[model samples]
Target chain A: MRSSAADRTRPTPLDGLVVLAVLAAAAAIFYFFRPVSGNFLTARIVLDNELVAELPLSDLTEPVTLEVPGVRYPITVEGENGRVRVLHSDCPSQDCVHTGWVSRSGGQIVCLPNRLVITVTGGAAEADAVTG
Target chain B: MTHSVRRLTRCAVLTALALAISVCEGLVPLSVLIPLPGLRLGLANLVTVYALCRLSGRDALGILVSRCLLGAVVGGNLTALAFSLSGGLLALGTMWLLLRVPGLSLFGVCIAGAAAHNTGQILAAMGVLASPAIAIYLAPLLAASVLTGAVTGAASILLVRRVPFDEGKP
Candidate 1:
């Protein structure tokens, strides 16, 4: 029937209010940074922190498989219109494969073990260079 | 039981419980269910909070380190050990500081700790990847932390209210 010191220090509603404020701020940040549709016509593939390939999504007449050195499996990048995706990968987690099509600026899919990253970039000159 | 022996027993029992919770939570595949990488309920943290409030800070830290090391070993992931250790230590430090604040309760302390944990893990990821773009994951991680931290914090508060852990007080 004895109460501990922890029990004596009761949490006020202010504690809940503070947590709610934090959650709201985090949600707001996430909303503002959410992927947006833009001139994202190219997908840049970086392997081992180096730029491996930059494929124009608009010009893909057929899918292309890129086998970067030092990685266990090849990555198949497929695109149509303005969207791109990793159709296949040999990475164990398959997180990149699960990411599916990314058609907007700021979208990214990372294969950590393979040190591979696929990201969409939006720019007129870069898109033109890749498409041309 | 004698006083010192009783304290040791309590620490052992709490450490084992925390480890069990950590290992069991690892098996749930929360990431697959939620489709979010590095997301977890952090159920074992309840024990850490309980210890921090009821027992000594040293006891809480001991339980936390034991849980992280044993959990990683049982989960069979050496890479995860780095992340967990960095995050766990950061969270523990943050909780220790926040618990001293005047108006803040365990709920606030836990929420801050969770946020700190996420930040530390992201920093570790950035280091391992050699890229700062991983910071983009922070918002989502923070949002997830709010939910999971609240659950664990509230649970700990309820537990501390009901359970008499004063016997092990140092």
Candidate 2:
């Protein structure tokens, strides 16, 4: 009797365990690869390397509307000082806000959907990349 | 001699196809609306997912491993290898598990695999950033995974049915 594809059993517990282990291991490896820190306040709205807006830390108190001629991008800067980033955007990808708060110095916020970027400049906040 | 030669030829062909897709897709610039780094379209995954069920496990692994190594070399960036490795392994493992379920077609299996792969990659990125806050991106990524997975899974199902499946014979 030929076995049909429908007779197959679902993945065993070992399979899930293996996948979890792989993810955890990869996380451990990348944790070591990230940079500690270098610069500060590199925060600027740059598109194609052209500075569109110089977003000062003080301006982050409320949502700012950035007009890109044909399109208007609403960038909301949330969170308090020390940790700051574009918390919201009108773009489709929402990648800008997803970048999270970039205050780690040398960290950057890039919104590919809108061709926008917010780069922060600061030095290392911690010694170890894992802890920081 | 013919059998061994055929196996090698098959692997080389699949590897090249996977690499080509990876590079070609990389050229298409599709950035996120947010500034979160390490996000991508994951187009190469379509090939990897297709190979897992259509071909043997070792063959699929061979294609993925070669694609990653050669892709990094070609792109001149070693950093991407980690993401691909983690995502690929997890995706393959998930597909393997789900593929066993009765009536779970390749489309369903691939969709599950895609979701798991994205989760794995995001987890890695979060670790690198050392910020649990990045977990918020999971929602968007999961959404994208469903869409991409469904498309890729459907394509693979077509390919499987059209292409000859003599090796596994299932």
Q: What proportion of the true contacts does each candidate reproduce?
A: 0.36, 0.02
Report how far off residue B10 is in candidate 2 (Å).
0.7
Clashes of each: 0, 20
Stretches of candidate 2 exceeding 4 Å from the true structure: A1-132, B30-41, B165-170
Residue A67 lDDT in candidate 1:
53
TM-score of each: 0.69, 0.56
- In terms of lDDT, the poorest run of 10 residues in model 1 chain B is B129-138
DockQ of 1: 0.24
Best by DockQ: 1
Error of 1 at B95 (Å): 1.4
Model 1: iRMSD? Answer: 5.1
